[model samples]
Target: MAKRPGLGRGLDALLSSAGKKQEGEEAERDLKQVPIEQIRRGKYQPRIHIRPEALQELADSIRAQGLVQPVVLRPVDDGYELIAGERRWRAAQMAGLHEIPAVIRDIPDQAAAAMALIENIQREDLNAMEEAQAIHRLIEEFGLTHQQAAEAVGRSRTAVSNLLRLLDLEEAVKAMVDEGQLEMGHARALLALKGEQQVEAARQVVKKALSVRQTEALVKRLQAGADKPGKKPAAARNPDVLRLEEDLSERIGAPVRIDYDRRGKGRLVIEYNSLDELDGILERIR
Candidate 1:
């Protein structure tokens, strides 16, 4: 006992010092250094789309105030991959920044996809098409189920399903959406039709500058016509359908379509290009 010579006290001192060093090491590890050029866009990005005007505005903001928040990134082979704040990154580039501050993470591709989708959805940065695409990517790329993706994006599985349905529209219709001419509601209405009918209805809604109701009515008419025998309604088969759809599509910034049957059963199809449009439709329906 006498020979112990305060060994316990010495050990206690050593342990306390080790604890402090460990804490200091952890704090140092938490510090991040991110390179600007190394920050590249992720393969499974959250934002499926962006508006030029919005980007321009963001550029202006970055030019004036600088990026308020640093972007998040993960290490990759060629460069640091973006995790969030894509808009900010794009704007930073526009603002002529050479290097950007970022927090480095070790997230897996699936986790990154999930995080990005959630970030975009929470910020309302993604349009309907973009959101749909993100959800699709999460499912396809990350092997997430529709329910899992929906949970990540804080949307219902049905809502995710409907968005995916929008992708089935004609390229022209999808182009209208990407261009911000047609909304998702307009697209949904158009989806009621098959092949050429979808395109035809989309044309009418745009040209006629039809209201959502009008578009829905036209879609209903076309659906009914399809169900009934004989020729379709004049409105459904109207030559002006395309022009009308274009006009309305341009006016409302959403795709529009009119559906009519020879039996006079008619419905107008209004396609929404974005989640905002879908939200508006939901509000109206509610």
Candidate 2:
């Protein structure tokens, strides 16, 4: 029948596609009041945590006004599987509704997953960690490239990359993010550290309730103090010199070292990874 819309065409196209009847498909595209017990949660559903209070609030709303939007579902062995609107489904169950309105369609696993990710992202329902994990699954399970994943979610490649980087965080730190104690920005800042330092820094961020900017500064200061093997302790260096080194390194996009003798005679060394980087640094200096 008609070609299924590409993931790059975005959520609207996908949702619209779900509404259209495809040739040779047994299911018709229409809203049906499906029994709550017959519709099970989808394997592709990306959301992990549903706040009790929020679900209660939604349940109250559904009780007062009814479900404004129908959840999308795909046919399965004995029951239908949720394709999107899991929040609505959960809230309906909580509201003690025997049946919920849903749009039944027959779609593949990948489309169902992409639709779920797009719906949650568009609704701003997922926390940073959940969103990251969803995006990551889109890549790993579907073999979509970074750019393709970004397009599927209607986000920039850099945004997708940043979210994926959150997955690199220590599990404890990721929990903090998932729990909303730390924001995405704070998590990204924490990525600058590794090992125990990252864990401790995450604790400090939550305990102190540090803002994103403050967390970034803390990461910089921590990096300055972190002593590596074969290197002098940065704590011994003048704090002013350390700050200068960090500032220069940030501005030049390279590692910078500042060494000063007691008489104030010293050198500012900028490290580069490549000849092109060296040329860029020289250009900046000029």
Give per-residue lDDT, candidate 2, residue 100. Answer: 92
For candidate 1, lDDT tens digit of each residue in 45-123?
Answer: 7665688789989989988987778887877898889878899999889888888777666655555666676677667
Work out candidate 1's RMSD over C-alphas.
15.1
Model 1 lDDT at residue 14:
38
**Which 10 residues in a row give candidate 2 its minimum summed lDDT?**
1-10
Q: Tell me the number of clashing residue pairs for each predicted model.
A: 58, 0
Clashing residue pairs found in predicted model 2: none
Quantify all predictions' global Cα lDDT against the true fold. 0.68, 0.78
Query: What's the lDDT of the predicted structure labeled candidate 1?
Result: 0.68
Q: What is the lDDT of residue 125 in candidate 2?
A: 65
Off by over 4 Å in 1: 1-33, 46-48, 226-286
lDDT, candidate 2, at 264: 99
